[model samples]
Target: MAGRQTRGRQRIPIQFIESQDDMYATFSKRRLGLYKKASELSTLCGVDIGLIIFSPTGNPYSFFSPGAEAIMERYRNPDQPVSGIPQFIDDHSRTQLVQLNQALDEVLEMKEQIKDREKQLDEADGIRPKGWWEHVPVESLNANQVLTWTTWFENVRTQIRTRKEELRNGAGTSAAPGSTR
Candidate 1:
């Protein structure tokens, strides 16, 4: 059997290794090959791929394309590992706020029209308009109206300030705020 016209180099079929020792060796080699391919693909295509591999033996290996860590550092928890996804719920929330504000503007305009009609009715009846404060433009209102708006504007400003604070705190750290990358 020692190559006396016998099989010298038998070709093992390309199948998943089942034996523990063979599996481990194949896993290690294949893992390295995969990472090499990933690196090559990133370099050639100018793409970024974040890869995390855990061996059957519980060994962990990771590969990240260039600027991957820096990219992940932004907008992610510094202490936590990052996946290749963006936390976009906040963006959706901002869009919803904008839509809600537009809807609110429409509602306010309707309310102003109703108030105008009420004023006209009061004048026809020789009654003084219900309140003098209703005459001002929405943009140029007094402290009481400002106070009323404070309920809405205050929450928006607080949310903005909180995000700003988070950005400031996350800068330069692994928790760095990502810039839509």
Candidate 2:
């Protein structure tokens, strides 16, 4: 009775854990499993593969088939020449290109978001013009269409003046259209 164990090892549940220590331990174990699988795959297929991972604390861990330098050497362009020294410029260039592409995509997405927001703001504020000259083709415009467009411009100018007057009266604002003041 003195040396008898009360509880035997029970099966661990497979589910998400909330504890940080437990999660880190799980991550470490999985990482080892991944490295083992990668090694086995490379050996079985006689293929070169490199895997690099960064932990949450920014520590880097890498596994490469054959060796890291060997894989990296094979990755570079064979036709490229170096002046008696190994140059990693090609890898850096590729990394820079990937970063630039990601940045460009982000910028384009932001531009679209801004355009959508502007459209929504315009719609909410009732800022649409009654007519636009660009809608009619310049080469196809007849005499009557040209006259009508000119009249529309004059009406828009008048509306602009009235709006400016209202703004001036409300807040003593300046910079009215076609004004020196």
Candidate 3:
């Protein structure tokens, strides 16, 4: 007998995922990895890099190093000299905005989860389940219940049989117009 095969990380083809949910999940995971790599590059190389990604759901994501603003300034206007003071101003604002947006998103998600959990608990509270009747093999709990349970079970069986017979008879009548019960 063959043992279970080990399925490690397999490379996925670079192609568009058809499912919307799967696409979003893939985007989030890849985006995170990309950000980490960019961060590592900036730290190790001591170079500035600004990375921007737009999610499939249209959310904007960005990572900026300390030198991000200076780089952007140079890109925008090559002739104009880059200034360190202005770089701090721009980077500070971008940092604050990114932090605020992330915090708000996390708070909203936490609030939503709490609300859903509360609603579920509230609904469950209304059920008020208790007693030996809640257990399976309910007849074991109360000997008196044995007769009642048996009768109830038989009633259900009888109803099912009656319903089946009625359906069969109805179909037979329709199929053969001259037939009468």
RMSD of each predicted structure: 30.8, 19.5, 18.5
Give TM per candidate: 0.33, 0.34, 0.41
Best by lDDT: 3
What would the per-residue lDDT of candidate 1 be over residues 1-181, giving only the tens digit for each residue? Answer: 5755745556779977789997987788789899879866865565556788999989888887544444466536667654333435333433564566579879999999999999998788675544444565678978887898778667767866877787798854333343221
Regions of model 2 farther than 4 Å from truth = 1-18, 78-181
Off by over 4 Å in 1: 1-16, 71-181
**Model 2 lDDT on a 0 to 1 scale:** 0.72
Model 3's lDDT to the true fold?
0.74
Task: Please list all clashing residue pairs in model 2, or write none if there are none.
Answer: none
lDDT of every predicted structure (CA atoms): 0.68, 0.72, 0.74
Higher TM-score: candidate 1 or 2?
2
Model 3 RMSD to the real structure? 18.5
> Which candidate, 2 or 3, would have the higher TM-score against the true structure?
3
